[model samples]
Target: MSELVIKDLQVSVDTEDGPKEILKGVTLTIASGETHAIMGPNGSGKSTLAYSIAGHPKYTITGGSVTLDGEDVLSMSVDERARAGLFLAMQYPVEVPGVSVANFLRTAKTAIDGEAPKLRTWVKDVNGALDRLNLDSTFSQRSVNEGFSGGEKKRHEIAQLELLDPKVAILDETDSGLDIDALKVVSEGVNRFRGQEGKGVLLITHYTRILRYIEPDRVHVFVDGRVAESGGPELADELEANGYDRFLKAQV
Candidate 1:
């Protein structure tokens, strides 16, 4: 029964010139077991919306409110947001040279759960998640995302999504650099998460390919810092055929 509500969200970024607005009056809702895909052209502020919801410091919420099950998200810090069951899989997953993947995942899980999972169970869970993503057992011993390929990094993100089991997941282009096989594996991981009783997915992507596999219950079109239109899964097909030209034309 988790519900994530975003109402009239207005966000801006600080630049050398001045403050530049990114998201404008964006409103949407994602409830448990619903997958919402946000499709838009480049520079349309798709990632900005994801980062804003994830409480990234670079973007400031100039207006509106976001809530998770009636709790104010704006007041929560980045870590607070995670502990509050909000997860963001970045478009570019960063690396940590010294942090083993196992250690990092356990630390993050402990932070969110307020207690460390039993080592035996946690190790089994970690290995299982990694195996599902087509990663080897040795991967857990490697430093997080260090020297991994692009597809591997994205798969690692999905593995986190599965292991963390958050209430709401805001994925910023999880399909960006994956091959067909890797894409399917990652999609399976997301689908696995969606199978849970209390989970929602906010999938931000430019292409409809991933949508074919993940199957969004709703699709929203973003253009020029605002949500231009929203509809069912059919809207993603419309974007594939007609493209954003029509939406951009409407803006002009």
Candidate 2:
């Protein structure tokens, strides 16, 4: 089974003021068959953690280590990390001009798999993935994330998550900007991925509402770049009722 271990992780970002630290000794583990939820307020470094693990150049790893299934994740390039089975669903999925969704998905799949999928089967799979997410088959003809609504962008990310089928998935604010119906639809896609054997999910979100649809095995309260506390599913329920005030105040 695959396991992603983060140990004493520290990260920084470059700004006009020089370097600013974001993640402070953040440590956690996500193993196959477990879904972990990271809940925090804005600027708490939740997204930073996701991006850093995915090898974003914007964030620098000042200290600590991140490993996926015993391999050095931090040392790998962004695309290398994906080929190594680490996937990131960005909070804001960028558009790829002139690249049709079908072509984009096929290229990514080929890159990750080291070969092209069978044409006939690939077409059927793509259509099925789109239909499951409530997207029309014609959606694949559009440029990736180009002129799509926020919900469509997020849904497309999940569709990729299923087709690509990585070992671990890091979703950054995936529930953001989704209406109730879209949230459920997106959540279903995430749940379907989690249902696969040896799949791991690290869902970063601001609200506990998404947790209601996709139950997390562990819930972490992130405050000031560190995980203040971690507990079972009940921890999410507590957060929904109480909020991050207690964790935020503990920092003072």
Candidate 3:
């Protein structure tokens, strides 16, 4: 039932001189049970698109609107959007020193659901979700991503996604710094999240290697802050074969 509609969205970042547009007019729609991949070269605004939709303060929306399930998302605050079932897994997850993973998970779960979970029930739920992702229970006692490796950091992000279970998940380069084993674990967690009611994913990455594990229903090539082309999984194959050179050429 949940759907994300991005209509002619444009974004810019603030500068002393003036605003510098990062995302051109862009439109896309994603419904439940669908996975969409957006691929482009660096500085193509792929990450900008994600940040704008999530209402990051640094990114300014100059044009268009983003609606989730018929509600205007651009007008809502960041926490409000998350509570409304929107989740963004950043490429570089920050470290929360002195905050245990267990505490962080509980807070996120409570915040997303708008209510604190009972201790007994919450414990089982948290443990079960961690087990599904092959994460050690001891990790819960450690500081949140403080000293974790690249793969561990990514896995921690995935763990948050699983625990939050937002209706729409925007993953920005989650596979960028992960190893093979970590990638598989992260992909498996994503797979488990998919194929369910009111679930959708927007995977933003430049490499097709992640697609090998998590198949996308559609792939869109982003160039010059707009979608240049969109097609099935074969588009990913083409990108793998020829890189983004052809697409970059077409954008010029």
TM-score against truth, every candidate: 0.99, 0.99, 0.97
Candidate 1 lDDT tens digits, 1-252: 789999999999999999998888999999778999999999999999999998989999999999999999999999999999999999999999999999999999999899999999999999999999999999999999999999999999999998888999999999998899999999999999998897899999999999989999999999999899999999999999999999999999
User: Tens digits of per-residue lDDT for model 3 on 139-210?
Assistant: 899998899888888888888888898999999999998888889999999998886776999999989999
Q: What is the full ranking by lDDT, best candidate first?
A: 2, 1, 3
State the local distance difference test value for candidate 1.
0.94
- Residue 104's C-alpha lDDT in candidate 3? 93
Tell me the lDDT of candidate 3: 0.92
Worst window of 10 by summed lDDT in candidate 2: 243-252
lDDT agreement with native, every candidate:
0.94, 0.96, 0.92
Q: List the candidate 1 regions with Cα displacement exceeding 4 Å.
A: none
How high a TM-score does candidate 3 get? 0.97
